[model samples]
Target: MNEEKNKGGMMSVIAALGANVLVAISKFIGFAISGSAAMLNESIHSIVDCGNEILLLVGNKQAAAKVSDKHPFGQARAKYFYSLVVAMMLFFAGGALGVMEATEKLFHPEHNVENTWLVMGILVFGLIVETVSLRVAIKEIKALNKDGLSLYRFLRESRHSEILIIFAEDSCAVLGLLIALGGTLLSHFTNNPF
Candidate 1:
């Protein structure tokens, strides 16, 4: 049963990583084609996603470590700690930094030199990738429920928090990407790349 649980969790992590990679590639294409600041922002966001996924995997592995004399209740809660770190990184490195630079850009302003098609393409790809991750996560959550577990109760007491962190980060990323795309289009229409 433990092995089966680990297998499913690992699969979900891999699926999330795959989606992030695909979206990252799309963002790179967006950057190469148009060089829009928003595209650059989106690219950075994807990069963070890639890195965060790795962190989540690490956290998951660590949390799964067998209990020993040195510690009890296993190392599962360590996953939450690491995932909290990831959330901090996202909040500070991804969102805060991006917002700061974007504000500066707003003040100074520049021409929209990015291709809308590229931005749109990347946005679409990101949406799809996030959707896949979300789907897999939901499936896992459902399985947990089928086993006579309440989703909320599980989250409150689960040893592995990678799933929750993955969901939160991916959802945040999707929203951020959408906002970036909207800003890009608004700039394109208003002819202000700021």
Candidate 2:
């Protein structure tokens, strides 16, 4: 049962990782072609998500390490440590950079969104990818949620950190993609990149 639970959690994470990689590449290409700041922001966000997923995997491996004389208590706490690190990265790296970029753009705004259609298309594609990733996470979590706990309570009490993080990341990614699409469309229509 433990193995099955772990495997289910891992499936969500792996699915999210795959989706993030695909969106990151597409966002980068879209940014290159369209010069859209929103696309650039999303590309950077996706890259961070990919890195966070990798760290979660590393943390899982560390948690599974056999006990030794050097530390008989085991390394299970490493998962929490990595989870905290991922949260910090989301704030400091991704969120901060986005804020700084937006401030800069506000001061010296670009004239218009170039290749608007292409940029919007890429964002829509990213939305689909993130939504799929989120659905995978939700499905896995629901299977494990045998106690019929509310999502909020489950997130608070669940010991499954990896899948929870995947769920959160994908949830945020979906929202971000929608916002980017809206901003891109507004910019294109208004002929302003602010």
In terms of TM-score, the best-performing candidate is: 2
lDDT of 1 by residue, 1-194 (tens): 67655544555667788988888788777777776666676677677778888987887788779999897778866667887998788788877887788788878776545567666777777887888887887677666554566777766666556677766666676786688678767877888775
Candidate 2 structure, TM-score to reference: 0.90
lDDT tens digits, residue span 1-194, model 2: 75664454778888989998999999899888877776787688778889999998888778777789987998877877887898888778877887887798789876755687887788788899889989999998899899999998988888888877888888988887788788878888877776
lDDT at 173, model 1: 63
Query: Residue 93 of candidate 1: its Cα lDDT?
Result: 84
Error of 2 at 166 (Å): 1.7
Please list all clashing residue pairs in model 1, or write none if there are none: none
Q: TM-score of the candidate numbered 1?
A: 0.78
Question: Taking the candidates one at a time, how many backbone clashes does each contain?
Answer: 0, 0
Once all C-alphas are superposed, what RMSD does model 1 give against the true structure? 3.1
In the predicted model 2, the residue pairs found to clash are none
Candidate 2: stretches off by over 4 Å: 35-41
